[model samples]
Target chain A: MTAYALLVEYDGAGLVGWQRQSNGLSVQEAIETAATSLNGGATPLATAAGRTDAGVHAEGQVVHLDLAADLPPARLRAALDFHLRPQRIAIRAACLAPEGWSPRFSAARRHYRFRILNRPAKPALEEGRVWHVPLPLDAAAMHDAAQALLGKHDFSAFRAASCQAEHAIRTLDRLDVTRVGEEVVIHASARSFLHHQIRNLAGTLHMVGLGRRPVSWPRELLEGRDRRRAGQTAPPEGLVFLGVDYDPPLPWVTSDRA
Target chain B: MTAYALLVEYDGAGLVGWQRQSNGLSVQEAIETAATSLNGGATPLATAAGRTDAGVHAEGQVVHLDLAADLPPARLRAALDFHLRPQRIAIRAACLAPEGWSPRFSAARRHYRFRILNRPAKPALEEGRVWHVPLPLDAAAMHDAAQALLGKHDFSAFRAASCQAEHAIRTLDRLDVTRVGEEVVIHASARSFLHHQIRNLAGTLHMVGLGRRPVSWPRELLEGRDRRRAGQTAPPEGLVFLGVDYDPPLPWVTSDRA
Candidate 1:
């Protein structure tokens, strides 16, 4: 069997997100079904770098799977894309990976972005792609408050109650808040994240941006280690899994295999 | 009655065109209904600078309406926005206009933009906002061919059959094509246009971009003045009415009325 990595993009509006669930269709189930068809009815398990929640989009989600069929990466990508049509998903790129490479564990960093439409009028063009906050937000204040959460710390205050991680300690590489025209943008990067961590952070920062919380509130929440003390979790629609980075980065295969 | 001007934005996915129609709900009818609610049940007429076709979006569509209620511009704007809730439309701005001002007649220029997703994948997030063209396109070739239709001409070749314009002669001010990442953007400007003129021009230019037709084909179509020989009229989903410009410039009232 050959191991392959696929770069995928999807609109998470209607799907049940990145994991396989009994409630509805999921990104994982859809892709595995398409791959199973190409593999002559044998199901191949596809593992993603991030199991994003429902209504959370992805621009460059990475997935890995093993296939018995020895097909060129380009043809595989094209075929998978064809089978995935009429759905809001695309296989952007596919490549052969080094043996035993894992998309979930081989990553060094993961990036995410959250968008807030900071305007009085509701969005017409970007309705579901953004969090509509009718009140004005101070981006600079939010940026200042976000700096308090950097580096290794116990992020229990921001962790979801259902998170499966063993510990709440994680290193946040970056957290930035900025305003571009009428939208407030938040970018975050880390080695990994707990369930609803980024969304919780965004919600807390939103309070600081609105002047309801002091600049030191995020730091206080971290010290308190109480999830209830943190702000409400931001909606999943505004969150996007940007991409992932790997140490000794996987050599992307661009040309067709002979 | 006080004459007022409004800057409006809307998503045209489910609504009819700007004009009132018996078949479906129109943008004009929606705004008029909201305005009439503020004017004590008397339906006010809303005239738009550009009567965009069905599924055509607008970012800054200029509109004029007269109301019997002497309300502040801010209050009027807020009331209309409140009543337009759950609808994919917004009143971006409102101001008192000079008496006798007409959105359709006093306009000096109209601006429009068309978006094409030039990629192999169908859009997930921007599904209805852009035209998905899977083939690779040469933006430079398209831009070069568009220059042929810049000057004044009798554009019978590009005019739609149902167009009610008295004359086919119109001056084209701008037609620019540029590639932005995976999308090809086309911007067109003119004092006025015949029905489906821009879409037809886009369709013709698309052929030139694909090397299906020579760069000189647009000029040849213009000279021939035969509508049947030109390319098909492009879909309305990709077209956007950006805004309009007034010659003397309408003085926008900023302060709230006493």
Candidate 2:
């Protein structure tokens, strides 16, 4: 059996997160079913870099699975995407992972993007895809305040109540906020994140953007390490799992084994 | 009665074109109903700069209506958007138009954008928003071919079968094609266009991009002035009404009556 990593993309609307759930469809189930179909009904276990919540989107999500049958990278992607029909999921690329490389672990960093449509009127073209904050937001102010939470720190204040992480200490590599046209985009990167950490950070910084809280407020919340002291968790619709990065970039050469 | 112009935007996934149709809901009917609700049950006629086909989106559509009850520009926008409820249409801006101004006839130029997802994988995040062309596209080649259609011309070759234009003579102000990441964006501008003219132009240019036809093919088709000689009309989903341009730009100063 050979382990292969698949670059994935999906629209998370109407999905029950990335993991399989009894209530509704998940991105993982769709991919696994497709992989199984490709292998003639042998179920495959697909693991992802991030298990995102429902209503979240992914432009460059990464996943891995062990295949009993060896196929070329292009053929694997084409066959997988063919069976993943009707679902808003795509297998962008398929390549061999270095021996035991796991999408969940053995990774360097994860990147996320949160979009906010700041305007007096609600979004029409980007309704469900963006968080419509109908008030004028100061993006520059929000960017300045986000710096307070950068670097290694205990992010207990931003942790979700249902978080299962062993510890609250994690390093936030980047938090950038910028205005593009009528939208304010927030980009967050880290090695790994506590549940709802990015959403909570976005929510807290939003207060500063709206001039409701001072720039020092998020710092105080971080130092306090109390979830209640932080602002509300931003909605899931606006957040997108951009992708994951590994220390040594995974090499890609078309396998001769078709 | 005072004439007010509105800058509108909408996601046209389920809309039945801009004009009111007996078959399904239309952007015009929605806006008119909203206007009637604001006027306490008097239907107001709404005229758009362009009457787009079904499934055509708009980022900056312009419309105008004569209101019996005058309100401030901001208030007018807010009230209409409130009444327009639940629909995926947004009144981006509302302001007074010069007396007797009509959105259709008073416009100097109309701008449109066509989006093509030129990739092997189908779209996930932008499913219904773009035309997915699986083959690799040569954007530079397409742009070179598009220059053949710029300036004044008899566009009968690109006109729709159902087009009601009295004459086929029209001025083509600009046509630009550029690659943005994996997407090829085509921008077209003119004082006006025949029904499906831009879509046909895009379709013809697409052949050039794919190397199926030479760059000189579109110019030859233009010289022919026969609709059958042009390529197929591009899908409606990829088209967007960017906005309308008016000479001596419409004044937006608040009226004293409002």
Compose the digit string of candidate 2's lDDT tens values, residues B1-258.
778999899989999999999999999999999998667589999999999999999988999988888787778888888777799998888888876778899899999999999877778888889998988889999999999889889999999989999999999988999999879999999999999999999999999999999999999999999999889899999999999988768654322232
Residue B126, candidate 1: alpha-carbon lDDT: 72
Worst 10 residues of 2 chain A by lDDT: A249-258
Per-candidate alpha-carbon RMSD to the true structure: 2.7, 2.5
* lDDT (Cα, tens digit) per residue for candidate 2, span A24-65: 999999999888866657998999999899999998888888
Highest DockQ scorer: 2
**How does residue A140 of candidate 2 score in lDDT?**
93
Off by over 4 Å in 2: A251-258, B251-258
DockQ of each: 0.45, 0.52
Q: Per-residue error at B242 for model 1, in Å?
A: 1.9
Model 1 scores a TM of 0.92
